[model samples]
Target: MDALPTDPEPTDTRPTDAAPTDAVLDRAAGAVIGSAAGDALGAGYEFGPPLPDDARVGMVGGGTFAWAPGEWTDDTSMAVAVLRALAAGEPLDDDRTLDGVVDAWCGWAVDAKDVGNQTRAVLGGLAPRTAAAARRSARAFHDTYRRSGGNGSLMRTGPVALAYLGDGREGDLARAARAVSDLTHAEDDAGDACVLWSLAVRHAIRTGVADVRVGLPWLPATRRDPWAARIADAEVSRPRDFDRNGWVVEALQAAWSAITHGTTLVDVLERAVRGGRDTDTVAAIAGALVGARDGASAVPAAWRDVLHGWPGLDAAALTDLAARAVRR
Candidate 1:
């Protein structure tokens, strides 16, 4: 294979340094664009194993959703919803902030392709209600699907890091992450996974290294021991060791496993999608972490140039949203 290029792609008007360090903007844009690139790359082969070495892995679309080549799936769409909510100029943990997110989610879900079962159930049922009422409805919905633990929440969590990080407040970041997850997913694991991944993205964007273990201490005592052990084990494991079937625990494990084992953005994304089932979400999750670590410039120009998604966002638009998100 050819070596991955290092030039930054044409996405978003690069954020000015007056707001933050150039590294911050680069990683912020990378987090959003990287997720979309990974989603589009993996979309063509959703629910399937890695292609043969000779087969092209570039975005060709036509998976279960039959998307156009270069188009991202619901993962990027939902994340953008969260980003839009944060861009509304309210505190991340405010009731109005959560309401904005809930509204954006329901609006997106109205015709969203490939919506997750858990998310669809909560949003479809509670979208018309007030945020307080929706939270209650989401809890009841959670009771019915507590054991399933889908990766729906985790897939869109990258934006939370951008919104809440750099404030010198990990607590606010955790609260925002949990709040975002609880909107549609009631399970503790689902919420925990979002916090863990969002914090990892925060650490990577702020520090230029993707370390899944950084957020382990923030987990509740009940989950800390098990999640810590699993993350430690995943760091040395191969991608196939994880069950990439959309469960949040396994999804987190799969993403962290690939990230720890791979040496570069290309290496991480390739290993992520090769696990087969839930390819796009797994790769998108991993992409957010590694992209935050490496910056948007690390994504290949071929993929970046064509990256697009629902709600009419291409790489540039998503980066613009991401830039605005980090500033808020």
Candidate 2:
């Protein structure tokens, strides 16, 4: 396993002056709205073969999970839990915040139609349902079985970026992303993937351009070169080449490959979904960077009009929740 930073965000401030601008807020909200939208769009096609070039994709749900049309899956549902946890206004890595995230995830998992295998093992198997219990279980699972690098963590990592959108919070963003990912996916690679993807989303939100490499500095020195090579490969490849998109690394590559291949948010998400395998998750992952790059306006109104998921959130409510959470 690769070594990655696992520190918590040491410094924080509720600076009103450093609050997100309208544009930044729009991009932040876009990350959430677009993530759910893409999840719903891809829900119908999960685990299928690569789609034909001319195949039409939309939020027409119903797969192995039988999701409702325009309804998100565990990807966005877990993300909604993270967003709610962040809205508590504590540091992202705080025990209180992580515990609240665990609590929310447990609540949602109780009735969620679909939950990731790794996530359910850790969450449902815990005795007390505390963050501490969940982490210990997840860590032991990885240490014993050595196969916890699923895409589950990365799919929900986009909302962690919103917690540190204030100026000079890049380090906080990286640390928080890893810390949250560790709650369910303690494998080093899973944490590393979340750090890179979260920082990329934050960068796109700040700059309105999608560049996944912007977070290399936050990774451990030993793994930086390898991740760079992976990113380079993604730039020259198509999403369909990543056949094992359920793994964290391939999921990132597939999502980044999708991101690099398209000119717009919708196009990128479509490319991600059509790549097949873990279609909803790959598209949900791409949606974060693309949405942060393109802003909420880039998401088509028709998609947002129908997007719905866990906790009874619609696209508009999702935007509002993300806005409120980031402001915390």
Candidate 3:
């Protein structure tokens, strides 16, 4: 592992704000590709504390897990699984869609070089494709792991937001986000972060601006106030200020801290990655939202050119899924 910085400077937030309209395909492609790029960029530095200003910090890959350069981990792979199911026109709330996603998740989890503990427990014991089976497995995992507030579900939820674009009500989107998240993480905070983050993604994709506040109305009263407070906190904090160790709440705070503070998509992702702990996931989560806000064009060409991940997907393949997902 490379030596990392013990103290990083606060992110500079002075870029001009621009909300450019883009084709749905470009926005969708941006969401997926941007996420994969962030994951790949941060993969090489996972858990290696922060980096000094002079240190090299692009997508060099090969870290604690030694991934190939430009290879994404489970974060993007799981989102692709959801996108594959949605591209087939399966309804979000239907058992068929959920079953297909669960099956895909099972396959990915079995072969994934990096799966979260909560996700591993839930999908590790999955049986046939039924709602009952999915619920039972998830519940069992929750029982075994009492404090299951991992960020596993949030990292994979970007596509779910895009899939519902222009088609469903905010409530529908929230339900879908919550349902999918509950499959592996049964905690309220986990589901809350998914709904909040997905809503932010959806808003960015539709309007080309990264304002998480747009999703506030969809949250129930119980969660709305708390999340609003958290979002406010993010606007003023540094990425390192939040715990980046995979806890869902802290993960959201970390990602949002980067998102709200950075002026461009690259700025957000780089800040998230440089913050160090859980680098890939934090950057991946920020990538989805910032990518949607700025479109695929915002992602650097160098990173996008080599982005690839599990299930043998390159940028083109992921972008194809994004296009198909939106067309459906």
Candidate 4:
């Protein structure tokens, strides 16, 4: 591979003490762009008609597409919410994080568009208290909802990983991922897998893409569990041929394996989409992780422009937020 050219020195007149490392900035940019592009591309096929393989390249959701070209679904919307909340420097406790998540949902709901059924149900039952009874009630409600195990939690978990990186807190990122996921998905397998994947993405961004060890620790626990183990074993044996029928376990494993095994952002996403179930959500998860690892430059340029119509925050804004989060 050719060496990347150095970025031109900043010419701004403002006095700045320092700038972020190129790798960090690149990761942030990749994460934001990759996520939006995936969301937009995936949105076109969201529980809808399929596209032929030849036309899949550079596809966006315009008139030819159903939901408007470049429009993101619940996946990116929820991710933006998490990123925004964490950018405000909130701590990662269940109560506080759940409140932030609910607040985000309410904000999106008030827009009166693009809300998912499962997410709406979970948010509708949320109460604004941290009392023991409230906690127990919330947990039970969330657990019941977890049975759905939709890819919703995994789709939105990227920001949590980016936000908590380098905080010197082992498993903190994973825990935060779980807290946000528990807002709508509290199943142990689903929630734990979401956290593990999020942490893996963060580790990939901070380290290089070669460190599969970043994901190994979390796998042991996942492997010990029957549901998670089945997914893991399947991914190890046949990553490219995994199933994806909104089964949380398979979806999680498929996304993780795609990132770990594939050589490029497109390869990972293609693997994810080909898994055949809940294709959009699976692609979204794989996209976010690969985006963080490879940086923005690695994503195809044409797809970035196609993601312009997505609901929720803009890609550049999210990148700026990630950069700011890193600086803080």
Q: Which candidate is the best by lDDT?
A: 2
In candidate 4, clashing pairs total 7
Residues 180-279 of candidate 1: C-alpha lDDT, one tens digit per residue = 7877777788888887888888888877878776676667766778889878878777666676558898888988888887888888888887777888
| RMSD in angstroms between candidate 3 and the native structure over all alpha carbons | 8.5
**Could you estimate the TM-score for every candidate?**
0.90, 0.94, 0.90, 0.78
lDDT of 2 by residue, 85-153 (tens): 776666776787778788889988999888898899889856776778888989887888878999999
Model 3's TM-score against the true structure = 0.90
Residue 293 deviation, candidate 4, in Å? 1.3
Extract clashing residue pairs from model 4. Answer: 30-296, 61-68, 61-69, 62-69, 71-310, 72-310, 244-277
After superposing candidate 2 on the true structure, give the runs of residues whose Cα lies further than 4 Å from its correct spot.
1-17
Better structure of 1 and 4 per lDDT: 1
C-alpha RMSD values across all candidates: 8.0, 3.0, 8.5, 8.8
Give me candidate 1's TM-score against the actual structure.
0.90
Best by TM-score: 2
Off by over 4 Å in 4: 1-20, 48-55, 62-65, 110-113, 125-138, 142-148, 210-213, 216-240, 309-312
Task: Indicate whether candidate 1 or candidate 4 has the larger TM-score.
Answer: 1
Please give the lDDT score at residue 83 for candidate 1: 77
Give the distance in Å from residue 42's predicted Cα in candidate 1 to where it truly belongs.
1.2
Per-residue lDDT, model 3, residue 189, is 82
